[model samples]
Target: MKKIIILLLAVVAFSFKTKAQTFHVPENYTLKEKADYGKYEDDVIKGIDWLQDTPWPLEEQKRMETNVFLMKWIQGSPTVSIEINGSVAKMTEKNPQLLMTFMGGYTKYALQNKTAFDKNKANQAGVKAVIDKYVVETDHKNNSLLNKLTKIDKDGKLADWMTSDFNKTK
Candidate 1:
């Protein structure tokens, strides 16, 4: 009985250690970790697609579908490099701070079949268009919150407000 109890305790302790390791995100993980995260996100996208494609197991499908939609809204670092034509377009290399917010917003808007901004309804729009729509809306309504962060002074200097806000997040 003593040996059995000891073995069970050992197993439980091992499982706890493993679970902790699985969820660990180091403060300064290497570039390889970024690539791995991107791969996992790709897998999530594919899994969502597969779940949607299946015909049977309707309840399980519905559950996974819901979970996947929520997962899509998560703001993650830009690990996935998009390819335009044959060339790799690395947004993270250029602007790491703004990548997550912009990408997440564009992704949610694009994938949700939401209506285009009210210029011309007949044309489908991409990320640039979506960002333009956001900027235009902000301009038209003079969105105070966004303006506070993004506004430029008369001398073309950036607002001091967004300097700290955009600097340390990454």
Candidate 2:
């Protein structure tokens, strides 16, 4: 009886220790631990492409850079590729994550210098058109997708000051 009780206690302690081994996720994934998570960024890029292909007014790089949410990615230094509707006609060499960065950088560069192709024209023009189309579609249909975006500007008034809701009493 004494030997059995001691053995049971030892098993319980060992089980507790096994269960206490906590998982360790990498820092880039969580910024809390230091584990080598390897390359997971490719999936992120693929996911962005998924977002881009969807009908969310995914404009060309040019216009997206100006938007603050998208701008954050650009400022971070990811490369951008511009596909017209679906064909791969141009790219920014930085990676898709920096589409806005490339867009913003290219726009700034064009403003300072004059080049004909390789993003001089298509990047800026494509981004602007896509963004404009997105905004119009969002407004005309009363889209919730851009509702957060609509409230971003400081004036708030500029987003759509002339709307009927703007003058509502409530």
Candidate 3:
């Protein structure tokens, strides 16, 4: 019985490990001209799961790339945005900093396309509400990220970049 239980546990653990490894952004992935929410649904869900379960990628380039990709995927439609927002909201206990990373992507995306982003009232409002919720729910005492988020919430913008001059560097 003990051996059988151990074997089952090992199998379950291995399956989870393999599942986590399966959903990374592909190297050839480029932002498509049009957002296809239906086509990328599974990838978006798995990517969010990975973000919630895994630590932020340590490499600067990899981190920024993943963040940008996630932002693009999640913002494909209002439905996708809601799903991603709910997942990130639940990350407050595990790693609230993920919210910062997610927002950083939004900032980068805006910088990349200022005109379109500025015109998108829905996107702007959604980002604002998320930032406000994060600031209210988390402790901001000496937490630089949370403090930054508070400012973003107030200003109705999120431009905190982990990398200096992301546009030039990339």
Candidate 4:
């Protein structure tokens, strides 16, 4: 009985059929044009973004443990999962006050774990593009919020995630 329930749930949770559930991520990322992510990087990025937006699957309660498996389904990259799990675990525990900060942390971790975290043309250009948009929108919001975002980069620059330059207008 337990096995059957688990099996049914496994199918439900991992179902790639967008109509089967609300787990679809059609516009998962803007990383499509970025070549460093490779030919199927767009697909992998979509899968990862899906995992990010959805509620935690009850069957896969220990997300940190299942990180490797999830990574495999998303083009077989474990590094991003490892860092995401760590960031999520930390944010869930250490600093609930920093939820927004942790949100950007996970994003940066995922992006930086890619081969393009360095000062390559793809990485540098991607960072600048993302940040410019972030600054404009953030400026309309609040500078204090922006400061908090930028401060969370204490972990690492990670090629200037949105949080890194949140203080530009400050």
Candidate 1 similarity to native, TM-score: 0.22
lDDT of 3 at 3: 100
RMSD of each: 19.3, 20.5, 12.5, 14.5
Could you give candidate 3's per-residue lDDT for residues 56-100 as a string of tens digits? 433345446556676776555443233233323443335445465
- For lDDT, candidate 2 versus 3, the one ahead is 3
Selected candidate, larger TM-score, 2 vs 3: 3
**Model 2 reaches what TM-score against the true structure?**
0.24
* Alpha carbon deviation, residue 95, candidate 1 (Å): 35
- Residue-level error in angstroms, candidate 3, position 10: 0.9
lDDT value for model 2: 0.36
Give lDDT: candidate 1, residue 33: 43
Q: Estimate each model's TM-score.
A: 0.22, 0.24, 0.41, 0.27
Q: Which pairs clash in the backbone of model 2?
A: 27-31, 60-127, 74-101, 78-98, 79-94, 79-95
- Identify the runs in model 4 with alpha carbons over 4 angstroms from their true place: 1-40, 57-66, 69-89, 92-170
| Candidates' C-alpha lDDT | 0.35, 0.36, 0.49, 0.38
Error of 4 at 15 (Å): 16
> Candidate 3: where is the Cα deviation over 4 Å?
35-38, 53-64, 76-94, 98-170
- Model 1 lDDT tens row, 26-48: 23323344454544443344333
Put the candidates in TM-score order, highest first. 3, 4, 2, 1
Clashes of 4: 0
Q: How close is candidate 4 to the true structure, as a TM-score?
A: 0.27
